[model samples]
Target: MENNFKMVAKTLFGFEELLAKELKQLGAQAVTIGVRHVSFVGDKGFMYKANLGLRTAIKILKPIAKFKVINENDLYNKVNAIPWENYLKSDGSLAVGATLNGDTFTHSQYVSLKTKDAIVDRFRDQTGERPNVDLRFPDLKIDIHIDRHFCTVSLDSSGESLHKRGYKIATNIAPINEVLAAGLIMLSGWDGQSDFMDPMCGSGTVLIEAAMIACNIPPNLMRNEFGFERWGDWDVDLFEKIEESLLSKTRDFHHKIMGFDKSPSAVEKATQNVENAKLEDFIYIKHEDFFKTQKGGEEHLHMVFNPPYGERLDIEMETFYSSIGSTLKHKYPGTNAWMISSNLEALKHVGLRPSRKIKLFNAKLEARFSKYEMYAGTKKTHKLEAKND
Candidate 1:
């Protein structure tokens, strides 16, 4: 137990509970949810596993020190007091990034500069050399958080945001974030038991994420690097063992996973990305207007998509939303459709009451994720008319 240390996995808004559940399911101990993060205790190997396995996590941070500071000078002193030599060599490169949530720190950039100066000064004074700042690639990536007078310094274990997943080589206009896509799929409660689809697949992010979840695949297996790989005490054998352990748990996915887009360019890009992820066998992308399509099978279908919202004129968007409602209501029976949109007014034109609506964010814009359940037989028409009324 002594070997276990507290780590925080940062996530997007409205995803704290989902990320917490993911960590707990991954065998984390003492899991607790924070505003946009989940803190837990895990050993170094678990850290590697979390980075590879957690579909909802943005980045994992290991807290190195926490202290109280009233002024900038106090911040410099406390940061300088940390044993940076143990984490980085004098010749190594480093980067410091900060987030401030209180009055004491007015500018996050200024805070990052102060922290970087302290570390560089310490190394220069003790070893006659200092690590240079490298934002793109660093030997050690440090994170600083200042809440009022409380300060926490942490080491970033995942080099890039986990959303990069390294599977996407091409992107279309306004492609969905991979982390958000995975979280949305999880929230929708799709488990590979039924056929899955993303009608407006764009670059096929959702379809890929759904297949990964269904197959129990590690999300970051395709990633080229992690922050821990460059740490001073990096252990190659331990990391490889953790990776193999996660890979061994991957299971077979039998159901169909498909995507559709009106644009031929989008279909091409999506196909390329699916091949890059080596999931082409499990995923199929087709160029077709989703509005013109019907359910291909009699079995229940689970759908999640991000439709165009407000990009066109108001009248056009309203018609588009209404067509979506009409298509699902009349054509796609025995299906459950979920969509996320920032256009609340356009969503109203859909003409069917959402059985469930959850507030979320698409980047900086406040959005809504809603669900529509279409049943089989005559009940479908009756329920659709009732919701419309």
Candidate 2:
């Protein structure tokens, strides 16, 4: 359609496919996956839907201009040539953020500052006033991406990252990012068909994300605002219609969603966050040491959690990981367990061999997301049974 424009949805490493899948499911066009990003075509309403419904995307950007620059001076000149008045009022507030992929632009901060200067200069020259830089609450947020000499300037449609789902008012130490949590759950192939659990649930992020995914609820439905909401062409009616459409598609989840934490304060915080997300009925948060508990019922279980590694890999972490393996191996039978941890040496202490291992990152630290399958009986017995079948 003529109204459709290109947009780039940024995501974490190893999540490009997940984001692309989400965009397609949300009705985006020409979906293409890139490293840590996905590009697609969509109308303004689809843009709003992408921001609200995408579970793995960090932010979405609508490119306004793309050019090749010889130097910073050329960048400034080209940026200044674009008409800023079309997007932002001369007296409005704005913010600029930049990313660089080549050695030509060694510092991202310098690029961001130059872009801001160019836009401000354009407004100042044409209207006798310029928008002030407001990093926190900007009326317009611009994103600059420089790959070698190529530059693409875009409007950030999602103001803050989409992970700020507005439901986590309280947090425990090392609470997982909501986008990453949701991606991990999808990667594990859980489709709301069976019981879900986070044994070491911190702040209940995983539990909340799992509940949302299970019910097909939009991840950002509770978000306070998106960058497009502050755009000059913001459409409240269209956005509301999109929201209603997403809500209409949400399905009821029959399986239980559960979380457990050893820390009382962590349990309290997770409970509060669950209540904040209005998922108390679907999600049950408990104060229990995971290692001491046994799996209940004969139904299958899907478990995903990120265990704490403290400051570094130490004796305690090794013991903690060993206990995790032992607990799953003995008590938590008939379960498919997944864990992400950056401590490679400590992970070796887990006696059970992982059925699958995928490289991922937790913040800046390189991590591995691994899966373990515990059978109802011994592995040998299960294998024999499978052979008979």
The top-ranked prediction according to lDDT is: 2
| Candidate 1: stretches off by over 4 Å | 311-315, 378-389
Q: Report every candidate's CA lDDT.
A: 0.93, 0.94
How much RMSD separates candidate 2 from the native structure?
A: 1.2
Candidate 1: residue 11 lDDT (0-100): 98
Query: Which candidate wins on TM-score?
Result: 2
Residue-wise lDDT of candidate 1 within 1-389, one digit each (tens)?
A: 88999999999998999999999999999999999899999999999999999999999999999999999999999999999998999999999899998887889989999999999999999989999999999999999988899999999999889999999999987888999999999989898899999999999999999999999999999999999999977789999999898889999988999999999999999999999999998998999998899997799999999998775424488889999999998889989999999999989999988899999988888999999988877776867987999
**Residue pairs in clash, model 1:** 159-227
TM-score result, candidate 2: 0.98
Worst 10 residues of 1 by lDDT: 308-317
Work out how many backbone clashes candidate 2 has. 1
C-alpha TM-score for every candidate? 0.96, 0.98
Model 2 misplacement above 4 A = 312-315
Q: Model 2 Cα displacement at 196 (Å)?
A: 0.8
Kindly report which residue pairs in candidate 2 clash with one another.
159-227
For candidate 2, write residues 1-389 as lDDT tens digits.
Answer: 89999999999999998888888888999999889999999999999999999999999999999999989999999999998889999999999999999888989999999999999999988889989999999999999999999999999999999989999999976889999999999999999999999999989999999999999999999988999999989999999999999999999999999999989999999999999999998999889999899999999999999998765423488788999999999999999999999889889999999999999988998999999999998899999999999
